[model samples]
Target: MARVAYTTPEGRARRDQLVRAAMQAFAQRGYHGVTMDTIAAEVGVTRQGLLHHFPSKVDLLVAVLERRDEDDSELLSTLRAREDTPLAEILRAVLRHNAQRPGLAALFTILSAESVDPEHPAHDWFADRYRRGRILVAEWIAAEQARGRITSAATPQRLATSVLALLDGLQLQQQLEDEPLDIDGVLAELLALLR
Candidate 1:
């Protein structure tokens, strides 16, 4: 059988389907627990077919993470385009979006914890992700501070670190609680503290 180029529309759609299946599987069971065979079955593809798209489980995991980040970055970019939008509101929008997609949230939370070991395939990816996130957020905080929008005496780097930590903790807590946590409210309070 001829292999379809991933650049083709059909190939791209098939690849997306496989990634979504893998994301759900990885979210429910950590990366180690999920098998390529299982993801292939969930997407109605043969093992070879899945391999043709992803090459390996790690590749599939990367695709899943990239897709999640692309979605989040798109949202952030849209919100950030509004110059008047507060940093806290931008973050609240992100949290609200994550709450709507619990599977993605769970996938991030689970993988981030699991990939902390240096031996894990995704350890470097997660490390770089956090590093880049902190840098971008710190820059934004500094810009806000310069605009006199953020009144906090704390340095932008420290504030960025705290914000990222709070967001991660809130996401984990939101997943663990049976009752829905008011994530937006909590974030609002934290941002207020920064102000």
Candidate 2:
């Protein structure tokens, strides 16, 4: 297997630049809107050069999603600021985080529809995302339950599934309609239910 050139500082920076350009393409044209030719041109690189980095569109999309995770990792710091309401803080942070990355969300917005099919590259991407998301939510729910802040009857896994479902449903609404979706309000409602 050919080694990906992500180890060097310059290589990493270049990779990030390509991912950002890919994100712009994702926002403007969605998943299908972007092509290898387009992304290569977007980065002012030759198609061959682009392929040298990302051999396929799936690779690039995976990188974009990974970039989202990396960017969202910054939300981790915000979680530390509030010790008492970690779950609430996480929900709020997720809201605030996506609010900043509408393009990233838009990327997701476009891809998620087609992601349902097993053939789609985005399918596994989203599945993995849901798994990780559920684990995080479950962890916080478990903590809250242990502290008697939440109901003991509600299993953390079940609550996590519900929370993630709400987030997905809300995002779907936001994408389908032209009106501005009340992300914070939706999160607040879900948070209240958790309590």
Q: Estimate each model's TM-score.
A: 0.90, 0.80
**Winning candidate number (TM-score):** 1
Tens-digit lDDT track of model 1 for 58-82: 8887788788778978887888788
As a whole number from 0 to 100, the lDDT of residue 99 in candidate 1 is: 78
Compute the lDDT for candidate 1. 0.86
lDDT of 2 by residue, 69-182 (tens): 777676766675676775766776776677677777777777777688888877887888789989988988999888877778898999899888877778777767888877
Q: Scored by CA lDDT, what does every candidate get?
A: 0.86, 0.79
Per-model root-mean-square deviation over C-alphas = 2.7, 2.9
Top lDDT prediction, candidate number = 1
The list of candidate 1 runs beyond 4 A from truth reads 1-4, 7-9
lDDT of 2: 0.79
